[model samples]
Target: MRPPPLRRLLAALSAALATGLAVPALRPSPAATVQVLAAARDLPSGTILGPRDVRPLALPPDAVPAGALRENAVGRTLAGPMRRGEPLTDARLLTGGLLRGYGAGTVATPIRIADAGVARLLRPGDRIDVLATPSPGAPFSRTVVSSAPVVAVPRLRSDQGALIVLATDRTQAAALAAAGSSLSVTISGAPAGPPQNDGPR
Candidate 1:
């Protein structure tokens, strides 16, 4: 026997509601959580990170990964050593290979000078200003000099610093390394103005 019209309509409406609700259930749910690696200690800016420097951040059980995952993620040091529990971001992650040139036109070069003593004062990752003074007897005694960021610090007893010259060309690198002992580097805040020769004579 067929049910009454109203009963049939009610039954159909109930089935439609169930079907609508079931669609959501059948759809795949997002991943509940993800693990992200972060720094475990204060990593200096420009410091290259290895497995040792990273720690993982696990999201809650219902959270999904928000961004692309880097399987072989490499982070570059953007600032000095970071404190423990610091979350890692692209700013601190090195996306490219080691010595991945950063800043403008940086390259490793040998800085030669007469006094190793002066070189000893500099350290890797230290910012400096390069000064040039023309030979005492050169005509047109204009001092041609430029400042390059130090990429590598000279080791104790080493006569030269393996510097990653910044904003410099091959010719400038050679000139800076070959100039007389007058070539002096004064550790300075990120370079200001053009290279200076007004330092104490």
Candidate 2:
């Protein structure tokens, strides 16, 4: 059948439009993610975490760190400085039995270093010798605990001396606790000497 050229052109155009409409548009599916606790802001070492300090973050399953904390981190002290969005891990908190990985019978002991400047230089994993002077006029100081590993250095307050947590046995912990405010520390690559049998009263 002979048709007008314009009418034939319009019929072809309508067929082309109908074919295009029949095909569905392609779209990619959303990726899967997992939730983990993360720091909400820049936090320094020794910060006791609270609800406002942490936030839940979604990340790819593979991107999640091993031992990442999914539960609340409240009441846990940070072992090191963490930037915003950093994931919380068990190793980062001073949890109960925080020294378990160090070895059996090791306890986390908190001690004050008389010299805040000296204590500020210490970090976790540093070996130190805790020394105590009997009096301000004392000529010499003695090592109370030698070769103790620093587990955490928490800055609690500016008005007080620096507080450091050390991994020590019961005996060393007792000596440190006894030494009280007269304590200072010396960082060492090796043991300074045998730990003194006598500690300041």
Candidate 3:
């Protein structure tokens, strides 16, 4: 037998009401997010960040990495390549903070590379041997510091030779200083050994 029209209407209304109530319970509330600076576009290693190089991104609190920067990323050099939207962190920039993890007695030493073209290829964290060539016709170059890790590669100027900062101990720093303008570098596989304190070898 067919239900009465009024009875059927009431049953449909009850079912609709139940669904409306359940929908709210099944849906979740929006999560809160925190804003942090991120790469605006694909950036190569050694790029000096500028205003347009970074943008603000909102991420879940737990998603944000330790040492992520909320601001002040501009003018900092990138330690490595970053994809668009990657969060900026202290570890990704070339700064004084980078030296802290290198250990005690470690110093950031700035040296001029004899070949600007060769220096241009270096990025942070690269292990290289600092060499000193005696002259234009020198048969062999001497290694001033073996397997020093490059920490920073500053932007080059037309009037200046390429300059790169290396993380080295006091002894290596002195040798690099003595090498001066004769400094050249060759990329090496891994660090050659623990920090050498016996002087340049």
Candidate 4:
């Protein structure tokens, strides 16, 4: 027989090898599940997303075999027939809420147009400045506010044209709508040149 210390060391080595082999089998395998956005109505460009825009989606949670991408793995796009009653991982979810609010205005207080047509021509994510002339006689104009990519253009209605909705209190909304109709809301940042006067030619 070997010495006492040598025999003990051999037993320890055997135990260690056994544990190493068992570890691989004990690990859980990946599943086939992913998250997706729920069906929602058309949200305005600058509208905020509440809790209604997100829902869970389930796929074959057991279909993801070993050595495959995990169900909870980030950036992995899953495309297949999904079924109910399976667990879903929320890795690729998207929300439609802006970081800041817009369009809430105050009453009866005229919100001047800052940069005129800038708001009307903006896309969903375009940055723009809101400039308004307080009055025709006012010496210099003022920049009422500045926002990023928050304007919502009217769809399929050329007659309505583009509408500029500013972020103001309830009263300001009424005031802006009322004042904008009469005031010449000239969009700024247009090709700078002499004004084209259309007199009877």
Winning model by lDDT: 3
Model 2 C-alpha RMSD to native = 8.6
Measured on C-alpha atoms, candidate 2 has an lDDT of 0.78
Cα lDDT, model 4, residue 124: 43
The CA lDDT at 73 in model 2 is 87
Off by over 4 Å in 1: 1-98, 103-105, 138-144, 156-167, 177-182, 191-201
lDDT ranking of the models: 3, 2, 1, 4
Q: For candidate 3, lDDT tens digit of each residue in 85-188? A: 89998877777776867788887777777578888789988888878876466677777877788877866533446778888887787777777576778898
TM match of model 4 to true structure: 0.27
lDDT of 2 by residue, 15-121 (tens): 99887876644445589999999999998765789999999999999999998999868988776668999999887778765575665667677777667888778
Task: Please provide TM-scores, in order, for all candidate models, with all chains considered together.
Answer: 0.35, 0.48, 0.48, 0.27
In model 4, the runs with Cα more than 4 Å from the true position are 1-121, 148-151, 156-161, 166-179, 182-201
lDDT (C-alpha, whole model) for all candidates: 0.52, 0.78, 0.79, 0.37
Clashes of each: 16, 0, 0, 19
Candidate 1 local lDDT, 1-201, one digit each (tens): 989999999999999999999999999998566676656777644455677877787666454234423345453433233567665655443333323555344434444444567676776555666665555675433333434555554242434422222334455555554664455566676544333333323
Q: Model 3, residue 28: what's the lDDT?
A: 94
Tell me the deviation in Å of residue 85 in model 2.
Answer: 27
